[model samples]
Target: MTVLEQTGRRPAALAGLWGGLALTSGVALTATSGWLIVRAAERPVILTLLTAIVGVRAFGMARPLFRHLERLRSHDSALADLATARTEVYAALIPLTPARLGRRSRSAVLAGVVDDLTDVVESHVRVRVPVLSAGVAALFAILLTGALEPGAGVLVATWSALVVLLARWGLALEREAQPLLGAARAEVSRAAELVARHTPRLQAIGAAGDVLTRLDAAHTGLARALRTQSRGRALVTGGVLVLTGVTTVVMAVIAGRAELPSAVTALLVVVPAALADTVLPFADAVRAQARAEQSRAGVETLLDQTAAVADVGRGRQSSTAPHLRLEGVSAGWVEGRVDVGPVDLDLAPGRRVGVVGANGSGKSTLLAVLARALDPASGRYLVDGRDVTELAADAVRELLAVVDDEPHVFAADLRANLALAQPDASDQDLVDALRVCGLESWFDALPDGLGTRIGSGGRGVSGGERARLALTRAVLSRRPVILLDEPVAHLDHATATSVMRDVWAATSGRTVVVVSHRHEGLDAVDQVIDLTPTRKD
Candidate 1:
């Protein structure tokens, strides 16, 4: 369903208010126009006063229209709200992430958000403007027929018919774009994600150029589709408008020659032109609604996917690691390679546990289970003897701060990195965490201290440095548990050992689980959980 339909309150409100106000204004304008035409015959000076009054009132009304549009379009708060919802939806879908988004889906979303959503905003305004303006024009035209002559009602009806036809065309266009745009957006976004995750691999294989070429081509395809749609609409509108203009001209000619009162003649002539102008806006409204529908689908689809995992995690909180247990947990990768546990394990707070496994072993997955990143296909995972499977997701997330092997660094500055754990963190806390990560030396060399950009893919920083930064982020998060996929994977012996020591010491009071093939760096853990072949088999 469209967002407007979902709300159910806004459409009627917007249509009723805008259309009613417009209709009311039209009645007022028609009365004034009739009066002006009548007076213009006997009191020629009255025409000047009437014209001045109309001009001022019309000018004054523009502000309300503009203000209403301002609320609907490009409001900073509205944009921010949309952005947040987008982020939330994105976060929720991290679990069921498909391998790749389809091509058609990608185009749909890009078309929807950047194009369709924007159109919806414009459509809303167009819908209102035309409704208001046409109502006013029609009122005047109808009034003029009785007071002035019969041609006015006929002219008004013709204008309304033209409007109805165009509005129908616009709605049709949007409805068609909805699914196509949805599919395209999903594809494009998925492609973007693929590039982002595999940039290093792409570069290693000298394939970045090729990838970009593909993305560019896809983008071009989306743009072409949008342009074609726009051109078709413009052509339809232009043709109708030509017809409308001809009708308007004919009305003016009849008004001039007719023997009706001057007031009536003026009303008959001017009403068609105003009515035509009002109806034309419906074209824009139709296009806008189409765009909104697609944008709404992109966002709402993402939103609708609020992970059952997040919901499942929303039940309990616990204090210790051993209090955390895994019971018969079985899950698949890429859809069916059952990897670990119908094996049991328990951990307690302040315990340091190491998970060592060969490549493709379930070590990383085990850590995720403990960290509450993945929900097991079946079996129970518990926190503090309470089914963590039942705990609130936010609570579970807050409790475990994970730094996986492929840690994701935000596109933010050095200090901002550690501060994400606690947005309101004091300078001292940041310093303390960085010191514990052995990153004080790196921080000291930066010109901007805490404000240097990390660049894309941590381009400005080394892998080891990025790893340390991730650890720092977790430490700053100040959670009860820390899950490290492989905290010291690529560091030199001394650096790796030191980073491990510092990390272990900083997280001394929390539950720590490190998944690694090599174990030299994490001797501080209380116990090691090995998912290595011999141990598991």
Candidate 2:
């Protein structure tokens, strides 16, 4: 089910019911207390005042009790919806990974999805409950006041109608600001992640200052967007208070000229002020309503995209790696544009090929096509002499393992991290894979051996070590075909050569296709294809 489809509507509706009761209780408390004060001051009989005092007590206690129940139900519903949305969105994104996520890093894309989903689910409590609660309480106030004094009732109804209009205006302002705020926040996040992930590279190239300047600019834009958003909320909340003051004044005049009892007149005067409390929360609801709309649009835009590669093809199974060939194959991330081109290549089993290209030469694009993450736009890609389009993409992908420049290390122990590639492998098998990836010495030196914690909060890893760890996983997979896309790009010359040496040794009998702009690892490959673009002029 889509995220919007599982919004826990029933629970939110129940919460709104409870919330309405709580707000109505609060309004009743205010009106009753006012009535009791006025009636007691008139020196009424003690028994008459006793009932008013008891009513005041009852409503005061009911407000808190109902409010507590409302909170419990509303929050529970939001949490339940959030859980389902996260699970479904994650599952839906799996097929689109690496290719359909656009040019953003996977971490950034996933982070955006997480934040958007939270916003969408939060609407149940922030938007639905508040609007429904206010609506119910306002309707009750209008009826009660109209019964006692029709003129006062008209004033209350007008005030409520104006409040609804004001909420619509507030929502429009919020919608205007949301896009700016979202873009600014995303820029801040992107800039921050770049600095955090590539601090050493930035410092090494003396570009740290420039990047920091860009980060500062991003923050400035975010602060500006926040100010813009706050202005809208301020206008809305301030308008609610001003309207309440006017309504209360008009209500007093109506009650004063009416033929009602002193106690009833006081109740009419206090009604508008009491309802103000409930209406004030609408400002927050307006903002949330606007935010949820934008978030849902973003998520739908992403999830609704047709995948770059087709899924329905003949279900051909392969017992071993098939001979792959790209006959004048070309592909691109966008339609009507070719990023990489008219290249010819052949990969018989166990043959190692290297693709060398300058930046923008589409080396990665070709590798994506080879890995079945992307479909060729023109020409043919063949597996075992059969057109690749005729075979299931997943079946073709099963024989290959890809290691890219950016390999993530989970916050886990050494054994757990490496074991994901081969879940049933023993400790000895893990150690062997580490040895094959040239990480045996590093493993032995670890403080806790295979038990050592790594990533985020644990022991830090050098770039070379991180690359080797990824290699270890690829080696352990035993997929028969390895595709390395600049796996050692971030490492220094010596480390890159050493890692490539281990890579060659570990995959001796496996077909390998390595793409890199650098010459550090190409010597080990059987053949190299250079794709330096020529100037048309």
Candidate 3:
């Protein structure tokens, strides 16, 4: 979690070693460059000697640069792994108190990937590269100046402060831009979430225009904020040029009259630009700092939520293994009231069962609890003669699949959609899956076959097809346990019958618990779990 740490550590202790090597190499590049300029000022003999010395610095840098690149690669891989680790936290955080994450979470995560990660890489590189390069460059510059004339050495030292000042001025402008840009991105995230959450209600009420109004307002705010930040960054750049020009003029005057020859004068004056370039990364660093703060806080929140719900406080499983069981598993539809089911229960493996209920019964919540997608207020869940607490939840998730009443079909081709369930599935395997789901003909008849791209949220497909497709994924996985909350709730008579037939066929030897309002859908099931709604005042 402490991404930027410098502890005596185990994971990639080589980060420090890489940092040192990169610093050493960058210094050599700077020193070589300055020496080449200084030596070229003298006669051919001196020029020849200076040129070789300059070239030596280049050669000296090669090994360090190679090692540093390896380090960069290691750190980048570490960062990516960290991202994967954070994703697990997000998965764990959902189904805690809330039902789903803010849709803005997707874009926020993307921003962290697209811009925030870049900020870390650039910030580290900038902080390392410039200081090392300039330090080496400045040291050589001073030595050359002192040898030529003490007055020139003193002048070089004086102008170094001006360069640092200019860097600070540029940094201030960049600092302001970073926060403004961060604010704009946050607004965009919030607006995206608002729209995703309200889309269903908006369609129901024909109030889509109101959703557009919210979107437009958020976009307008973001656009205005970005423009302001862009203008500020532009101003900083202009200031950099002005500062660079003034120093060049002052140094030019001093070098032109000094006893040192033209080449030495050039080295004394021209080399400062490289030094200036060194500190330039600070402007970028400022923005990185702001974005990193926002992302890190987001990650922290996610981790904290994970820690809060962890089974650490509960006892581990020992005897009396129940394929599934829940104790004190209480939660509610509307926070304090309408709560249901602290029911202690158990089920056997490979048992087919039906969860029957009228509207508002706690049937669906029970399915969620068994799926490990929802946590009970307090409970013990056993799977496969072992306590679930004994397994990493992520690994446990791989063991079960759910077919919700409404399922999301990615805006992707048929093959791509199926691949989400099993990325390495063969073509024939996909064809077999389609066949089992009664969708093979529908897919094969398409102009693009499995390559036909569906519209967003299955726009180009019918609701029944979407339902079947989602069911297909769960069926194909053939997980140890399958929870079908409402596999055929939206299908018409004939279509529902076909889907239900396949459901029964595929689940022949699997453990399955289905929840459905359709009596016909459950007529063939082993036992019916009757969860009638409690009468309300």
Off by over 4 Å in 3: 2-143, 146-180, 189-209, 231-236, 256-259, 277-281, 307-309, 312-323, 332-340, 343-364, 379-399, 405-434, 443-466, 486-497, 515-535
Model 2 clash pairs are: none
lDDT of 1 by residue, 36-98 (tens): 656555766654666747754884585366446434432433354445444554454455332
lDDT digits (tens) for residues 356-400 of candidate 2: 989999999999999998889999999898887788888898889
Q: Regarding TM-score, does 2 or 3 come out ahead?
A: 2
lDDT of candidates 1 onward, in order:
0.64, 0.90, 0.62
Return the TM-score for candidate 1, rounded to 2 decimals: 0.72
Q: What is the lDDT of residue 297 in candidate 2?
A: 93
**Residue-wise lDDT of candidate 3 within 16-62, one digit each (tens)?**
34543454445445545555656655546764675567566665767
**Could you tell me the TM-score of candidate 2?**
0.89
Cα error, candidate 3, residue 17 (Å): 12
Instruction: Give TM per candidate.
Output: 0.72, 0.89, 0.68
Residue 5 alpha-carbon offset, candidate 3, angstroms: 4.0
Stretch of 10 with least lDDT, candidate 1: 96-105
Cα lDDT, model 3, residue 159: 60
